[model samples]
Target: MKTGIAHLPLHGGKAPSWLFQRMKRLAREITIAVVSEYGPQEMLRRLSDPFWFQAFGCVLGFDWHSSGVTTTTCGALKEGMKGLEVELGLFIAGGKGGTSRKTPSEIIRAGGHLSCDPEKLVYASRMSAKVDSSAVQDGYQLYHHAFIFTKSGDWAVVQQGMNDASKYARRYHWLGSRVANFVVEPHQAICCDSRGDTLNMVAVASEEARQSAVILSQLKPGVLVGEIKKIQHLHLPSRHHVDIRDIHPDRLYKIFVKTYEQAPENFESLLGMEGVGPKTIRALALISEIVYGKSPSFHDPVRYSFAHGGKDGHPYPVDREVYDRTIEIFRNALRQAKVGNNEKVDA
Candidate 1:
């Protein structure tokens, strides 16, 4: 089934201390309920589901339709899961900004504790980030990444990126079970507000373009730059907003030089190279389309609301006291469930 998506307006400011503490407590209780009822894997699957993830954030008193939901929820989960990792058999690694860069090491550490293959987990962590940042060109620069894994190595990824120009955030979801090809149609769901033109290299429709990009990468730097120059010098109608001027010749030249030196064996290797980024990928895809007759997917992959939205009144103003009451209810229910009494769980 196609997972549901959400469009969230970007908002700023940290979640207040009181609210965040309660959110952590509530998140922990709900996670306990879920794991107790279903299982750890089920909890991971639900977190990887965009709709359910958003709802989970809302239930914890976060903004229902703001970018903060992604960061705040993941932060809470990371904190709440600390003491439960061994019992629940799941671990959360990485987070916003610099913490995200530490994911591979974190995964390796967790893998060591679980006796799973650390190399494989590290690779998964890196590739998942690369796929979203490079393969999916949705204009959102990813700033947050969260990797969740079970002791058996079953994993899910939930990350968010922001586009300052549009003032919106996009969330990407991935499940290990659902991923057949990391290069194509790998996301379980991508949620964002805006949908327009995007150079989606990961789209199923872009297979030919991807192949052509690999072939183009094998060419000499001079030859590749020559072709780019041809497009750069072209004068088209006013309606054509695509300007080769936007393509940095120096950056492309550098990428081509690196590609020639490294001689990457495949698309994955090319993407894994240190200097390759969204712009580099886009240029290669564009060149493939113009020079090789293979067109990349231009369809923006954004597949598709708030409790009391946020504290600053985004979707709606956050009700502090009511939010506290909601957390209290979950706390009580969790306590009852722990003692073998679930009759009050719904009350």
Candidate 2:
């Protein structure tokens, strides 16, 4: 599956239709091969690994550096498994843009065939998105999310966010086996071209700040706004990560009222509050640091290959004959292979 990953186009979104059909068939066969050899859980493990996932897109004939790799690869995978989910015992839900928003409903639809509870899967999907977009503010707004899960309840997330100013895409990865908390240092890896100052409320060092924000949420709306204004006119220290985003007093008061009535018990709950978002989270973190003197961590949480190992390419379009031939070879091999070999059948 080695490829010319270095010559990939960074922004070339989606493979053409004729190629995508072949991609889906190849993706499906690959999944079958992996699941046949190592089992569904192992398949989940591979998808969660950033290196392997990127390599998978490359083998499927996608440009390595393209931001669309995240969305397009996930799309191919989801489409590939259409009616064989129960037989394969693996499932993929969610995709780019509005498709990402339909993840919960899709998971629920697949619930009837799963042994694991669907609600838990739905919550993990939402919390992962929440943490990346709001809890860890790296200035990239998430537009693509892919959730991969097995019948046993294990799951993994592949999500990407777009930075309008820098025009760069950052990807986040999560493995359920590695996560003990949805809101605290939960990502297994994040991939980006370069590191930048990020307001990371989910960092371990930000624990005190998180606690302080929850406690502050209990205050009256007017009282909270009063504390917020003290820092409104002041500039935040460069070394410090606490700073508010663009927010108006009236809007803040409304969110304050909701949190006041609900009284979130912890940082995760505070983040899950209906009206809470990146701006509001920044405001809370800012207030916690300035008014309450508890600073959140300014650490960026990316851990892996620098920018997914993709170099600029010279438009070397994929050869259809070779691509189609590759698919047929795999299709034939899988058709002839005995899926559950060396068990009762072999004996």
Best by TM-score: 2
Total clashing pairs for each candidate: 1, 1
Q: Give every collision pair in model 2.
A: 7-313
lDDT of 1 at 16: 89
Winning candidate number (lDDT) = 1
What TM-score would every model get versus the actual structure? 0.88, 0.90
Per-residue lDDT tens digits of candidate 1, residues 1-347? 12334556898888989778877877888888788788888988998899889888877778777899899999998898778888888889999999999998888777656757877777777787888788777677899999888888878888888889888877878777676767877755556556755677888898998888888888899888888877777674453323457787666888898898888877878887888988778778878878987887777777714544465665567777777776677778878888889887856
Q: What is the C-alpha local distance difference test score of candidate 1?
A: 0.79
lDDT of 2 by residue, 172-255 (tens): 777887778877777555544467778999888999999999998888999878867767778877786544546566678999
* Model 2 poorest ten-residue lDDT run: 1-10
TM-score of 1: 0.88
Q: What is the C-alpha RMSD of each candidate to the true structure, in Å?
A: 2.9, 4.9
